[model samples]
Target: MRAGGTSELKQPSEEVQQLLETVKTELEEKMERKLDKFLLVSYKTQVVAGTNYFAKIDIGGEELVHLRVYKNLQGEVSLHSHQHPKTREEDIQYF
Candidate 1:
């Protein structure tokens, strides 16, 4: 994807899973609860000083979350932000 442009939403790759795992603890802490499910629905990526990933995760049933995670040029991953209680019908975009 071009710098500053967001990529089309696509299936989560091994890289994306690893990124999520890197911040799983932080995520759970921010979420105020442990995740019972981690179904990745799709994700969009943007090129910046680092790369940004906007992901839609199915926590369970109709409940979902939108996550914005960043991977720096040095390849360190961090959770940037998140939106919770999303539905499957909601379009996953930059939040």
Candidate 2:
């Protein structure tokens, strides 16, 4: 990856999974819908003062979303943004 470019998609790491789990409720609230049976398909990352996680989420059925979750240097995690109704063919990118 370049100085400020995003990394390629990788399987969610243990740390990534924990970060998502830590912010699940916040994410659902932001989307204004429950995320039941959601799968963490893949993710890309951009490192800055904090790390931006662009993740492809499979929320069952045809409902998919790409979430930009940020984890700061302080280890705080939050849902930054999201693109909904994404397809399996869509590549995860910065939002």
Candidate 3:
């Protein structure tokens, strides 16, 4: 997994690095846009019967996307992404 903080960006393992590269390439190809820089944040990992990894990717401030990567016992890997939800405040009226 990869994470960014005040100190510096933590380096991800070789496998994670490769996965990120693949994701970037796929996004570029599908979107037909060049991705300049990516900021990875809120990286977390969970291990059990399988491995689950999650993180958020900031693409040049234009968009923030959520990433979910999973690896199963059979060594199968799955990557999925979705648009991050925006936070908003609204007045609440209780009945």
- lDDT for 87 in candidate 1 is 90
Taking all chains together, the TM-score of candidate 2 against the true structure is 0.89
Tens digits of lDDT, candidate 2, 1-95: 98999997898677677677676787788888888856788899999999998988788898878888889999888888888889989988778
What pairs collide in candidate 2?
none
lDDT of 1 by residue, 1-95 (tens): 55577998788787787677787788899989998887678899888898888999888878899999999999989999999889998888777
- What residue runs in model 3 are displaced by over 4 Å at the alpha carbon? 1-18, 29-32, 74-76, 84-95
Global CA lDDT of candidate 1, please?
0.85
TM-score of 3: 0.51
Q: After superposition, how far is residue 3 of candidate 3 from its true place, in Å?
A: 23
Candidate 1, residue 22: the lDDT equals 82
Q: After best superposition, candidate 1 residue 64: deviation in angstroms?
A: 0.4
Best by lDDT: 1
Alpha-carbon lDDT, every model:
0.85, 0.84, 0.52
10 residues in a row with least lDDT, candidate 2 = 12-21
- Lowest-sum lDDT 10-residue window in model 3: 86-95
Clashes of each: 0, 0, 0
Instruction: Compare candidates 1 and 3 on lDDT and give the better one.
Output: 1
Please give the distance, in angstroms, between residue 70's alpha carbon in candidate 3 and its true position after superposition. 1.7
